[model samples]
Target: MTVILKKVPESEKYILRNFCSLYLHELSNFTMNLDVGEDGIFHYVELDNFWTVDGLSPYFIQLGGDIIGFILLLERPFLNKSNDYGINDFFILNKYKGKGLAFQAVEKLFKEKQGQYFVIQVAENRRAIAFWKKVYNRLNIETHERQDIIDDELCLIQTFKI
Candidate 1:
């Protein structure tokens, strides 16, 4: 029942790459339309940037001792904002869903990183949208939402200041 967000180190970047491929595969069900390349792996082009970039934090969602998924956090402003942070990616394995672990993990993160932040979910991903809605409601925080085009696809962005 112990959910933790373990910060990933540079030497463990490969772990993020491997898990992100699976995360993307799971996301393919929700309008991601991802495809594996000739190498037979779903490559995340920005995996390297998480380490090299100044304002990015990558984490592995762990339950006790086992790694279940990951969350990628980005700092600096986005979506035309001057000072904001963002949840770049979040995923929990199917087996881990509906157990309230996601809420605990994110709540713990919000407690540690307090600032203006936004999270974007693909417009077609009702599951993601629902999850974020529940998160905000449970956190009891006010949020601003809008529909916007990102990477040429319609997305729902939720902005909040904690």
Candidate 2:
């Protein structure tokens, strides 16, 4: 499985939008309810800003030329703190989960975008928390975990310097 990150092109923006809906649908099972419009669009605000914003990067996680996931990275620091790159969104399709593909994709992402990294996972998403922990541990990097309240929802935040 050759996992690669390809920058999403403007012409393929719809692909990301569709994937965002899928990601949101999966997240809704662990987090708060989301109102995806009748057209099944989720994260419209962020989607709009991502296209116009300079610091935002949206990548398609491709496995041998097939897109199986998406990752959204914010070049800016988390909460405006210096040196932190925010992992705004990460999702692997259910059919591709638990195969170490996410680890490979994230490792490539970190190598390509090196900086202090911050990732937030819904407190209720035990799988996500465990996945990040395992990834950091495998890399032998020290990570700091904390609880934070974002948008009035408690979340698990993991920060690491790589």
TM-score of each: 0.93, 0.92
Q: After superposition, how far is residue 65 of candidate 2 from its true place, in Å?
A: 0.7
Lowest lDDT 10-residue stretch of candidate 1: 76-85
lDDT of 2 by residue, 52-99 (tens): 878788999999899999998888722376555888899999999999
Full-model lDDT, candidate 2: 0.85
Per-residue accuracy of model 1 over 51-133 as CA lDDT, tens digit each: 78778889999998898888999886322454457899998988999999999889998998888889999898899899999
- Give the best candidate by lDDT: 1
- Cα displacement (Å) at residue 36, model 2: 2.7
Candidate 2 Cα misplacement greater than 4 A, ranges: 40-43, 77-81
Candidate 1 lDDT for residue 6: 91
- Error (Å) of candidate 1 at residue 6 is 1.3
Task: Return the lDDT, model 1, position 118.
Answer: 90
